[model samples]
Target: MSIDIALYDGHPAGGRRTGARMLRLSSPGAALDDALARHTDPARHRLGRIDPYGDTLFDERDAGAVFEEATALLARCTTEEQRAAVRELRDLLADCAATPGSRLVFLGD
Candidate 1:
């Protein structure tokens, strides 16, 4: 199983600076373990600590839930642009599920 990981920048309201790297793993159990190891490894110098908040990995089941949630969110969008952005997010989530190993990242502001 091949895992694809990506880093993204994001900021939450009234939150400190932060960053995250998303990890998509084909083999859920094994890939999750590997991702944790890589995150904790000092040599890599990637992340400081794994933040539980806003951090999640979706397997088949979780992916389904996310799809539903994303759809609902998209439905609430008032503008076409907002809807499109939500649609893109939905597609990314779907791609992560489809790929054997895939990941995504949302960095802090």
Candidate 2:
């Protein structure tokens, strides 16, 4: 399945964090997404201990940067489909960035 990027008011799965999801670079494979997310900031958007195996992709702080990186990569990939994804990601990032307690989470890798 493709990556599902969304904004949550609090921690997903009924956890204890408060934030929203935003900014998704590309619906690439899990390996690619992890590599990109940790590319610039190694310890930027990391999950919690609950996910010891790192099964899911969750980035709380510095999420905007991660999303920004993804968006930047496709900034010039203006094909119809690419353009839609880019625009959607950009809008989501902007919305979350403007929101106070919004956290951008990239699911499915």
Candidate 3:
């Protein structure tokens, strides 16, 4: 099994809250993680509203640079499996970007 990080549509942290599931990434998604963090820096300059983290929910616009940076990171990968994961991440980001009001709701365990 692999450690997976699942993205949801909104804040779905508590046991009582619910959100739509979006994307799932394999373990050691360092590049993706870093890209997400850089994009969601929460600083005024970054245009984010929260701290730099892949929490339980987020707006697609909030993590705006994630896709580009992740794709750039993918270009440096050396393995087929890693490339595959990046491809999946790229597709997921594309889908999320195209859909307005799309929110990220969870970072699966």
Candidate 4:
């Protein structure tokens, strides 16, 4: 399984959405899931709740919190792949946080 991350111009509504400005990032689902599962406190780590079987949306308002959580997770990454993936997530979250109407979505499968 793999997870795909993308950044969009605004909140995507149903089937009418424009192309995302940022290139989508894909990472091994198991690797990310394992890293998140190892988080010591999932209750406080918002990113840990990413649904591997569904979609996870983070809008501009959620960017700060998501970025913080991603930073924390990045610190605990045991493998290079995990670190790289979380780093990409952090970058996307940062962009979303800075853009007024942008959103980040994690497509899981």
Count of residue pairs whose backbone atoms collide, per candidate: 12, 11, 6, 0
**Could you say which candidate leads in lDDT?**
4
Q: Please tell me which model should have the higher lDDT, number 1 or number 2.
A: 2
CA-RMSD of model 2: 7.0
Looking at model 3, the pairs that clash are: 6-108, 8-104, 8-105, 8-106, 9-105, 56-105
Model 4: per-residue lDDT, tens digit, 1-109?
Answer: 6677777777655334554565345554566766776763657777877776799988888987777778878888899878876777778888888888777888888
Tens-place lDDT per residue, model 1, 14-68, is: 1335433333222222333333333343343222232323454344344444666
Model 1 root-mean-square deviation: 16.4
lDDT of candidates 1 onward, in order:
0.42, 0.47, 0.50, 0.74
- Each candidate's root-mean-square deviation in Å? 16.4, 7.0, 6.0, 2.7
Candidate 2: residue 92 lDDT (0-100): 61
Best by TM-score: 4
lDDT of 2 at 35: 35
Ranked by lDDT, top first:
4, 3, 2, 1
Evaluation by TM-score, superior candidate among 2 and 4: 4
lDDT tens per residue, model 3, 18-92: 545444543435544444344444553232332324344445774455667556746765666566666666566
